[model samples]
Target chain A: MSAIAAGVTGNNPALNIGIFAVFVAITLVVVFRASRNTKTAADYYAAGRAFTGPQNGIAISGDYLSAASFLGIAGAIALNGYDGFLYSIGFLVAWLVALLLVAELLRNTGKYTMGDVLAFRMRQRPVRAAAATSTLVVSFFYLLAQMAGAGGLVALLLGITNKTGQAVVIAAVGLIMIVYVLVGGMKGTTWVQIIKAALLITGALAMTIWVLAKFGFNLSSLLGGAVDAGGKTGEALLSPGKQYGATGTSKLDFLSLGLALVLGTAGLPHILMRFYTVPTAKEARRSVVWAIWLIGIFYLFTLVLGYGAGAIVGPEAIRAAPGKANSAAPLLAQALGGPVLLGLIAAVAFATILAVVAGLTITASASFAHDIYANIIKKDKLADKNAEVRVARITAVVIGIVAIVGGIVANGQNVAFLVALAFAVAASANLPTILYSLFWKRFNTSGALWSTYGGLVASIVLIVFSPAVSGKPATASTPSMIQGVDFHWFPLENPGIVSIPLAFFLGWLGTVLSKERRADKYAEMEVRALTGAGAEKATPH
Target chain B: MSTSHDPGTRPDPDEPDWAEVHGSAEFVELRRRLRRFVFPMTAVFLVWYLVYVLLADYAHGFMATKLVGDINVGLVLGLLQFVSTFVITSLYVRYADRKLDPLATSIRERVEGGAAK
Candidate 1:
């Protein structure tokens, strides 16, 4: 195992860095070109709503499929087999909630941010403030996870094992991401995502076909190979209970994770913001359909890639590697097509991180500039029309710096929970308020505030007290993030099951307790959301 | 067609009467049509997903039962989720095209046309 680990780490770092540098150079040129059209607040924030459905769909997939989906899920399945595929199912299924409940409606009602829709029928300042707060919190947590993952990935792929070296890599990634957002804004960022998505899907498809060919294009043979390579625990790989089925509490935890993954996508600030990049509600719907196909197809590839890694790379060697489960796909690439293939895949992984972080940074900065600064602070009375875009650029730089610092601090910790926390927060904090504001005529400012703040607070509190934070005894293979601490009181790892219902209840309670009802506002919002009447039109450049 | 359209009776010259539109039979029917499809469909998919999760949790033996060579109940069920998602997406798109878009377009045209007048 040690020898195999050493062999995997002996990958050509120079080749990997060379590939990554070329990708960065190309994307920067694209960003510079895309920035030419970004003039207004609309252009900076939403690419002037010029993207066709298919183009936006590919970009959405790029934004949606983070390093976690590509590397994390593939690694997970490679290690855990059937249990790992569960994450893919949860992720793919979550898009349906986005498509059915939110996509077209949000595209019609919102201008730049989720705050736009929430404040449409409510008191603008307070509601916009609440929406911005949640959006920032969600985006920050997600950014931290991606940034931290970047550090670990470079260590594994480029063999940059030194702490300062990994930190430098993380900072460089952050700097590049900042450049992407500051220059291209939404238009540039969307192009980056589109390029990344195309590369990621194509690369994964190539590897998937390669893996299938190894076993005569038979899935059963692939599964059998995985089972065979798994040794003593071989048969367990083909079934559930390997990862989440240890005890009753673990089983319940799986359910909580399921709830979060399925309900969370619709509320994700970054994902929700992507809808504004398209021309119309119909285009938004079309983009979602495209995202579903792209994302769904990518996940199917992960299923094969995971089992293939298990079969070819073997679990023992994968476990011994630096990133453990996260090392699966890269190691599989090495085994199948040697260092060049590994380098290309590593570049794709880097592109995944850069694209996703750019998306989050833009969403967070847009929320702050559009919601907090323009609406809350300046009272939507900016002296200059371009001030919002200027503020957004500055906010992007600040967010990039914060993410860099946070990533360095969280570099070696168990950061998986952070991404899950983001999902939980979105589902609990944002989703309920969005549903109520869009559908319930009686939903008032009080309900939106209560649900957004309440859900945000509840999920964070639950996470702080959950076993994921503490109380779980570290195994020989994995260490807890905070060792020597057992302060956890909440039994579950995911806060979605408890927090989601609590948010819905609080939203209803908050509305009933307040006597504020705006029938006319609700009517206007309903008409606009459903029929696209009086919605923001795509500006002709 | 409506008294609100008469300049003498209107309160705001530019803003359409949204409450009136909301109360119109077409808007009500449109909302109903949307709710009728999405609400039940949402319920169905969520229930289907929860059942799959619950089964995976408690019914380990059942899920592990081999359906074919190296293929088990769990893998098939998981793949079915992908299938179900694709099916639901296609069905919703078709339904929206057939029942929702035409109605929404007419409502939008009438409201915007009224506002212009």
Candidate 2:
């Protein structure tokens, strides 16, 4: 990295630059070829639902395992030890929510977006309107987060802090992501995710094996070595609350964050969208099982990477920069595999961000074009396949531009928090609406609308006033209100504990109060959701 | 191709409407069998996972209690979380294969106006 940073890479940069170019080049080629196959709206939106369970399963994991999991978790472990592992564990367990409740039923029910499922039984216009708002809110925030993180990651790799260089990096990434969805559609996106997932798993495994072998294949000793590496703060390193605790608000914060982590994936538009790419409910069921195995296998390595970084890289070296902890795994890569392997990891992380953002863009486009524009605004426009595809492609460009601009503007913001906020909002707003629609008989259009809008608004309003948004430092001499405005009253960083239940309550209350008792709606949904008897079929190729 | 098939809104004529399917013995049995596994599994996992989280948060020393050299109670519970997810998933898949799949097939056949089970 220093060699690259100093413009003195000579040989190492070639390997790094070569790998990056080849990966991007291959992706571009794949999209170009896929563009030919993307003839219909179903083809564009869901790859004609052609994916096998294992294929889509691998793609789902690829859609997951963001730079946060690859980079941030390792850093947390390096800096905070056992506490860092909690974030990864929470993420892993969250899949239970997806696997058991969301994935297969979602595959059976929806065509394009979450709104498709929610609006399946409810009054279409109002329910779709609410779903569209939440979808955009989650996707845009998540896109901005990934894009901003892209700029920083690129800047770190190039070892240049120049604003122009960072902006250029962000633009390049944004453009590539836009091209991916617009040209190749879901086929292009899924292939990218598969390749990226393979690379990620391979990279993580190689690094982990190297770490374990270095410790003579003894696991506990590696952990012990980590414990002793701390000169005075060794005990703190082994404890549970280093990251979430010590602030006197640890328990509430931990639970709220946990709630968001567990329930958030069920609501994410992109992850939910993966279901529509598979062919059958059986495959959907099998896909989650495959995803479970792959993700579980990966998390084992993540644990090794974390502890290995803590032992090899040391906390002091990791904490050298304000948010430099994310560099822990990369630094460990350099230590273990030299600049060559480090380059590989960097390219893979770039791929991770790219694939994730591509998924986000496609899902957002689908929602805007299908739900808001086609269904709501242009409802009476006689069905035109060409028009819907065109609208979606146009929406993709607009969303891409917005995300790029947001990414560039929010460059200095803490992207990690942005992602957490997205999760919190997803859990609070989208999850309740989905659950009620799928499960509850009394669940009316009013309940769905109230939960979606109420959860979205409630989460955002609470976050705006929360200390995490703009933290207030005590003492006037310390810093002014700019550090954080003093009016911030919300206690927890995550709104899941508060907003999630409130959304559920709002849904229930609205249902009970409303005169619309849609037992027929529930009856119909139950049959379809359970048996896939009358559900949308994969387009016959 | 772009426009979604509005299938669920108006049930097709050949297949019995959802109300009939809902009342069918096969459908009732299917629901019961699914609930037998899912309800218990969901409750147990949620309760157990929450306990681990609460203990970690509220009971620090208990979590940090070292059962083996350099290993602790917290570590054991963490490892179990992974173990339990696999156990539940494997169990569900097996149960579904043995129990739910055949029942769903029967329910579908009946809903399509097949011979009564």
Candidate 3:
């Protein structure tokens, strides 16, 4: 599945790297200015809850649509045809699940992280510990996936073949993300995301327009071009069996992947974190409305970009190198308007990666400093707002270092697969607990703790044993066998089919079997979650 | 700002009385109306999406059935996913405003008024 791209003109990709550098500088300047306003934990964690529905909406879209969607899915569609479009549909629909069932309710019930909601009706310490544990688990997998994929992606696209050079590039990315979280916090990060989201949309739109305009704005001709370029395999490209659905396990694999995508978006810690940036439930709901439309339009553009790249760039050229699929958009830009357009896209991609990494870092740090260290460890230190803020910043530095190391270790993995693993964990572990906390009348401390922990453990164990981690070719696309070991058991690539149900069942079982009941507080939490009665108010920084 | 000052904090007494709000008919009505939208909609969307996934996986001929020129059933079906999402969003917003919002407002007003005393 790794396309060893042929004919890389190898003429100094420094132009692309140079563009990435400019983006980093602009982000730093904004972060520096924003730092002055982030003296409190509220500013550090939730952006002082000042973002309007539209602004937060844009930021949410930025956070949700990472390199995986922008680059990975485009590459998939370019290579696999119809199945690639399936990924986009799954991602877009997941937002609706979030907008309808989770968003406003989450905003009304919780104040900071998803952990806030999990601990809302349960015993504070254990429930929070479980929540923080799951949050870190979800974020780390997601962060590692983003960091690792972006590292390889930058190095390859810039044509930086040196290992040391790649390491340096990744290190710089890690350091800058730390700065964004440390200096700008949530407020600074939001602005960076807004700018990046706009750039990404413009870049994708330009490519789609350029491609479609080539074929007289006719989508069928675009499909025809793809077929013509592909020769005999071209017609097969229009269908699904070429990428998936060929093997007997394909149906199960598709089902697992579907469940993860639809259920996972609602559970993602970073995406859920965005709901808290707005003050009211109404604003929270409105922001989701903006996100779905914005995100929907973006996915449609990817469909055009993906097929256009296949038709124009050709599959042979893309497969000439492993991971040339990731370079589809950039290569398309180069094809359309030469180096200038390519540079613009490459820079936007760099900014997109930075914004997402910064968002993940802040959320992870908040889980550590606010939920675990500040809340659970030093329960009495709650009044020391300055100290909590300080610890959160320090935690950001630590998380940044860990992400860099993990990225290096996970280098060369497929960006999209890594993202799927993260989603599976979120959907399986974090989601059931959040739903039960807000909705179920009998949910107790034991049930919350059991479900959270059970889901996390089940996801990790199943993934490790799944064919995805133990297949073959060892590339991001191939079924990977871990270090040539292949101790495989699970058949499905995604763990959602098994783990999601297991997590929910464990929560229910724990509740039914437990001696202690929480009925007294359940109605109160339900009221707060539903009506925003006595919900936490946003403060000015 | 509820737990900003103290980590692992309990509900602040300065806030509204939760038991009163929980018992209110408006709060009950809000939960019911919201569920009416969420529960059914979630089930329907999941089925609609899984049908797409299953057809793509099992019935490739159907998905690839060319309809009107070069366009296929698969392409139209895939695009419909986006359309359905927007329709659901618009519907939810209208429903929330018409049914959920008023009940929520009444509950909030009653709680705030009682807390003010």
- Please say which candidate is ahead in DockQ: 1 or 2: 1
Ranking by lDDT: 1, 3, 2
Listed per model, the TM-scores of chain A against the true chain A are: 0.99, 0.95, 0.96
List, residue by residue over A1-541, the lDDT tens digit for candidate 3. 1232433324247777788888788878987888788777777798888889999999998998898899888888888888889999999999877877788889987878887888877778898888888889888888988888876676657777666777888888898888888889999999889989988988888788889999999999999898888887889878776777768886778888888998899999999998888889899998999999999999999999989988988877776643567877776777788777777887888788889999999998888888888878887356667888888899999999999888877777544566788888888888898888777888888898788889889988988887777765555457473656777888877888899999999999988887777665776677777778767667775
Query: For model 3, what is the error of residue A3's alpha carbon versus the real structure, in angstroms, after optimal superposition?
Result: 15
| DockQ of each candidate, alpha-carbon based | 0.48, 0.43, 0.64
Better of 1 and 3 by DockQ: 3
Best by TM-score: 1
For candidate 2, the lDDT comes to 0.80
Lowest summed lDDT across 10 adjacent residues in model 2 chain A is found at A1-10
- CAPRI level of candidate 3: medium
lDDT per residue (tens digit) for residues B11-107 in model 1: 4676677899999999999999999999999998999999999999899999999998999999999999999999999999999999999999999
**Candidates ranked, most accurate by TM-score first:** 1, 3, 2
Against the true structure, candidate 3 has what lDDT? 0.82
Model 2 lDDT per residue over A1-541, tens place: 2432233122265566578878999989988887787888889999988889999999999998888888888888888888887787778888887777777777767788898889887788899889989999999888888888876676556554677877887888889999999999999999999989999999999999999998888877778877777667766666687766666676788888888887897899988988888887888888788888888788878888888887887776666532377777877887788888878987898899999999999999999888988788887363676788898999999999998898888785665667888999999899988988877778898889889888999999987777666665644211222363566788876788899999999999888888887677677677767776655667776
